[model samples]
Target: MFCFQCEQTAHVNGQAGCASTKGVCGKDETTADLQDLLIYQLKGIGQLSERLRALGKPDQAADSFTLYALFTTLTNVNFNRAVFTGLIAEAARIRDRLRDALAAAGGDVSGLSAAVSFQPATDLPGLLAQANIASVRAGLDLVGEDVIGLRALILYGLKGVAAYAHHAEVLGEARDEIYAGVAHALAFLATDPDDINALLAEALALGRLNFTVMEVLDAANTGRFGAPVPTQVLTTPVAGKAILVSGHDLRDLHNILEATKDKGINVYTHGEMLPAHGYPKLHAYPHLVGNYGTAWQNQQQEFAAFPGPIVMTSNCLIEPQPAYRNRIFTAGPVGWPGIRHIQNDDYAQVIQAAQAMPGFAEAAPAKTIQVGFARETVLGAAETVINAVKSGDIRHFFLIGGCDGAAPGRNYYTDFADHAPKDTMLLTLGCGKYRFNMHDHGEVAGLPRLLDVGQCNDTYSAIQIATALANAFGCGVNDLPLTLVVSWFEQKAAAVLLTLLALGVRNVRLGPSLPAFLTPTLLNVLVEKFGVQPITTAEADIQAALTRQAA
Candidate 1:
């Protein structure tokens, strides 16, 4: 159907839709349509919040509910039919109430109401049935060349907010404003606007709000997990039956570790889960063995040959092949129709799956990957880090965070890491670190040139580290000798970027390409306000970023 929710939309401006039988990402047509509907319904729920708030009933605002709902609709969170259906039904009820409220207010809100309308045309076929397929293609069509960029930017920002809000809810942390604000903004974006300037302004506000939501999520994570500490994680799979856990869900990782503790089954982190090694609470699980696989896009080949069962806790789930289908379990929001998905948020099914599958009985890894640069560990070494900076031993801090993909261009990350100067330090989080995490770049002073700061969600750790450095330097975050070079492939990355923007962190570099959703106006706003730029050649980008610091 007409889906442009990700950076990998078909190249054609108007006509390139996901294949009807299969998606570019291996998602079948049904899943793609459902994702579209999920977003549409979330918009409805968001519209309802606007109504409740306008009625001086701000207390009635259901932020947690809206945020969770939107989060569920994010790229790779939930995929269970039952769960998806229930949420859709709930959203429908909320949408109906919103329609009634706006109608009764005697206010002409048709424009805002369009997104949530419970009409057949909202279904998948109806959407794809448009005679001109070009109309549904991403970029240069939906919002027009002029405004498409802006709309995409705001939409992506909202998606980021929804992700952070989602994580916050997982930890029992609720912020009504984030939920309501995101929903209201989504509803507004869906509105048929006659004033382009007004839309652009709101879009900018969405970026700002996304930042605030990310900070809240950061606090929630650190508060619950304890500030991440510096620890070493192994990449070599250990002996005995092993289970590989991927995606960005720490809670899921915790549950799996708890379920398999001393059960003769060892657990390993993959993709964004690699950062789990930093949390004392999580690392305490002795059997939580090292990581496996390189990055998200390499899953098919990696997972196929792995000698253990694999569990996905979040995004970047490649649809499994028959060769490894039985050995895999999808948990949390990641779902593929034929795949065995965890029925509940619980880990019982995952445990059972691991038990039934053939797993590793090999020896411990030859070497382990280092981790644990979270706030506390880094701050604890604050004096050492500060001194190093002062001595010019650690000349630059490169914050390389974001998702990993199989695109040829993704090789830029590896090259950049390989080329980082001897005195420069690379602080990496998220699966993107796969490019160079496995490589030993030697050390800067006593510290490893590359520090694995945990998973994508652990962007919190990066922020904490940056803030501490800024405070020590008596300057804003940007003024600190740090740079952010991020690679995004999903909504979670979107949230992290928004958080950076919200905090007014400038001069960040994003690559391999900008999202297809952003309209030109929105892109300009981000470039103008945040100084965000696309990544160039690894050499050029690194030199430019480093040169800026020397300036």
Candidate 2:
């Protein structure tokens, strides 16, 4: 499989891969092929969405269908064979309907990719059997690295869009434009792999559309959850049966909390799920417990040591160690070859898994970990934070955000955090914070300089805070006394970077490394248009950013 959807792609040109047969992320040849097919189908649907929109007939079902399909394809979401096939079949039907409609409308779309036309039986298990046995693989050996990288980038962005769209749909909110954009993006990746300039343009376009999608998701989350507040979540799991829920789906967390309520089970957040504590609806669950582990890469050790069952809601799930294999359950899009998966969206199976596993045993509760700084909470503190800036108490604002990974170069984030100016306040979100969350960066005038604004979804908080500060200071966001130093490892981070670019946030530094997916021409466009840079030494980069701001 020639995959380069992440920063961790095997080669810079994208021709290299994690593994020739199976993915480094535990994905086998079959899964990778299925993911490609799913992307293909979604692109078809995207073409349909645009056609419908042109005809003044935006389809909610089409939008939802694309969202669900994309969500299923995201990293670590769906591994369950049966669940994936069902979604693919559903997407196929939708694609067929749209293709027929487009054809009737005299839209000569006969050259569409085979992904749109592929059919799967409605029977979930049957489809799974076919996919599992068919031995489908990416024909990447025939393509150059740059083409592979660009397509991977496109696919990853669509996955992120799918996730945001799913969150919006959860809250009864939908954006047809965003859905159409994602679908169109997928189609572009499938057909135009060789167009370097076109790929770069699409990457930027993905970024722009993602920004819109994220804003919609932000509204849905904050509106439904009553905004995030500053609160510390305990890491200790209380005594009793417990289930560790990881990944980014807050709605699933709430549902689990509801299911486990009064059932003597404790729930703890892990990885991206740690931000769940900031949500009023989620944190209100007394037995919701605390965070179980750090970022996604540490799951092997963390899950191994855990005392109970675990449920994954989204990406960053590694293959389970044998020690904890029996106790892990896949929910939503996350699936593993051998893991038990919850079906029918009922989540009853997850609850049952928690009951069967050893429940949480009594453990000592520790100091609270501070969280909750979404748009509302940060806005509430605007007066104080602003006043501090005005009084010279807060010297600099450093937005250190992006994805977390296991690569050695990732230590750059930890070192950067360690070396940042003492007076500089760190506003971070996403798994990227995994680098420095354990470090003690002493307070700055009674406030913790290293402030976490929840998960990647909460990156909106950082954006809002920047915009608000700029408005308060009567300047554009770029002119505000803030710097964006990002660390990206995957597609969601790419989406976030695009959002920053779309908003005209300039002089942003991204690392532990630049994405292998970007062609030289594509990279040049971003550098010229946005002044985005790859990270160098922390000291030098920080000094340069500050000097530029001072000038």
- Candidate lDDT values, in order: 0.72, 0.76
Task: Give lDDT tens digits, candidate 1, residues 1-551.
Answer: 55556666666556444555555665555555555565666666676667667765443344655666666656555555455556656666767776677667664565555556754244445543422322223434444655654555566667667766677778777666776688678667555443668766776577667666666776777677776777777788766777888877777788788778778888888777777777778888899768787788888888888877888877777768887888788875567666777765667766776777668666753887788777677778788889999999999988888888766588899898888888899988888888888787898778678877777766766787898889998988988888898998877787677667767889988889777666566678779977989899999988998898889
* Candidate 2, 84-136: lDDT as tens digits: 56667777778888877777777767676655666765664445444532221
Best by lDDT: 2
| Residue 303 C-alpha lDDT in model 2 | 92
Predicted structure 1: lDDT: 0.72
Tell me the TM-score of each prediction against the true structure. 0.88, 0.90
Candidate 1 TM-score to native = 0.88
Best by TM-score: 2
Candidate 1: residue 510 lDDT (0-100): 89
